[model samples]
Target: MSAPPRVPRTRPEPVAPDPAVPEPAVPEPTLSELAVSEPAAAEALDAHEEHAWSRCDPWSAALRSGRGPLYLHREDGTRHPLDIERWCAAPDAADRTVIERCRGSVLDIGCGPGRFLVALAERRLTALGIDANPHAVARAVRAGGGALCRSVFAPLPGTGSWHTALLVDGNIGIGGDPPRLLRRTAELVRPGGTLLVETAAHALDERLSVRVGDGRGVHGTAFPWARLGSTALLRHAEETGAWAKAGEWEAGGRRFVALRRA
Candidate 1:
């Protein structure tokens, strides 16, 4: 018999905060401890237990320069351009839709450069942004928004109590496993709280091993990522049984889905 196919290994990026500037303190949970019920996921995570920072240097360069010619280069050679400029800019129409829908305390997961955090603060809403890139966190702080260098799977402050958790800008693909991410988000949100996720405009449910590339041939560390459209997202949410679809809409060519925690 043929050997089983190897599962793609993806270790969480653990970026240390800049020593020049202090960041808020939050306890971190071991990667080994998450999703223990899912043996395959746990095994995959454990496989890379000692890997260091996810070499986001190429991505860091783009954020530091406040622009992008960056793209996600898949193993198959398909490249998806990343909107670094928009993420560095002020919130646009689609972002406004998300900002307006936010309530109570908010957690911006994988918040790149903190545009949404700043927007939320401008409205006087309590918010915090967490990212696994030290550069992104530093940029966010410089932009006058609260941010921490951390992963979503790590233990965060006020776990199980946030009013809203955001997975915008294709962040839902962070772990390359949508169902696992959905389940983790459910742990972070309060009962009946909401999860606002951005999805692809068309039907798409794909997992890819990719690296951040400058489009000039430079690439960063390879990581597993996934993408989901509204249909795929709804299906995963139902399967998790931890979320119920509350609403779905499109603005500025971006699709969003609102999920109420069950």
Candidate 2:
């Protein structure tokens, strides 16, 4: 009887995969890749000097009292008073003179609270300030200036396109290596661009491990810093291969040197 009328056979429904199971794993990063991926962590480890600038309100005495007696202690057992007030103030006559020399787009390295940047903007110049401290950058932006929170050693915007790079307010001490710093600055500016640098009034060239200390026996970690005089800066300019001493001037009892790329 045709097997009692062929029973209709139906195919079984396809089983759906489990949703909770994870997809195939991604290969973990190698050691070198890990190091490269987390560059900010490495930078944070070496940024001991940033403690003061990162945490303290260097502008207001009421705020500074909480982070008191900040001074730069040198390896040679000397100390230099860090004048936070002056750095936070408006550009003085000397600073204005330096600003006048800025011909085109300006990059102010270590631009503390950005008084210079504000001044340049007021004059309708294309200017940008960079500082390692977020607080400083915020203050600058709040004051209607353009600023970025970054170290000069870090990759910057518009490298080799800037017409002027400033190392004012003793920022030449960055990394405590003047020749290296000058070389880097040369790379940042276009050919024939200018670098306006502030130098120590005295004829001294020093590389020191410096730490900030509060008079109340509290101190931050130490980092390399440098101090150079006009003569020493000129020598450094010669060593940097592309820089030449263009001129020198004095402002507000501070000495500055102008270097032009050859």
Candidate 3:
């Protein structure tokens, strides 16, 4: 018989908030409220203070279990499975390609569980993993990688000095505004530094409100996300005037683009 999949022997302890991204003084709606609230109302929450990103939300639970029956349910009734298995596993061939191309101090935005950070550390490379999910950050640290429970829009260490910034694993869709995210990333990367992005497999460019849902029909807060193909990503980069496409390639059926800060 095949060996059973390994599971965590114990529950992860609560993680402390990273000092780098302090909580705001204002009160905010709970994540549960955001789940049933209008998307427009949830959108009003500060990017740095989105409860779904910080609390023990569905994403965090899935990460803790090292598996998933998770899906991103779009407002239009479309659903996309989040590949939690692949995310929790070691870096695959496609991930390796990105790792090889990384240069200088690396910043991994929305780095869930720090698989890349672990891989980068194996190569003795300087890298830091940042995520809003506290559980994911704890997992990354326990796996012997450096991570911070912080959001990209919040204050971060080494602003405008990171040699490379990464947006992979569908993180390009973060906040549902590709152009604005691209522009913000430019501000984080040093002049002439690089931004490596992974795009969708096929031709696609869209922005939509989505929620984290499980097979049991439970749903979490709604948040904005975007999907972009290489063409669309390049176009956004061009429009921002902060990056130029250095190259594009495909591996393991995934497409990626490398952009140099202009």
Candidate-wise lDDT, in order: 0.76, 0.67, 0.75
Which is superior by lDDT, 1 or 3? 1
- The digit string of per-residue lDDT tens for model 3 on 89-126 reads 89999999999988666789988888998887666556
lDDT of 1 at 82: 96
Q: How many residue pairs clash in each candidate at the backbone level?
A: 0, 0, 0
What's model 1's overall lDDT? 0.76
> Order the candidates by lDDT, highest first — what do you get?
1, 3, 2
Highest lDDT model number: 1
TM per candidate comes to: 0.81, 0.76, 0.81
Q: How would you encode candidate 1's per-residue C-alpha lDDT over 18-102 as one tens digit per residue? A: 2432222333223233212222212223222212123556787897898889999889899999999999999998899999898
Which portions of model 3 miss their true places by more than 4 Å?
1-45, 48-51
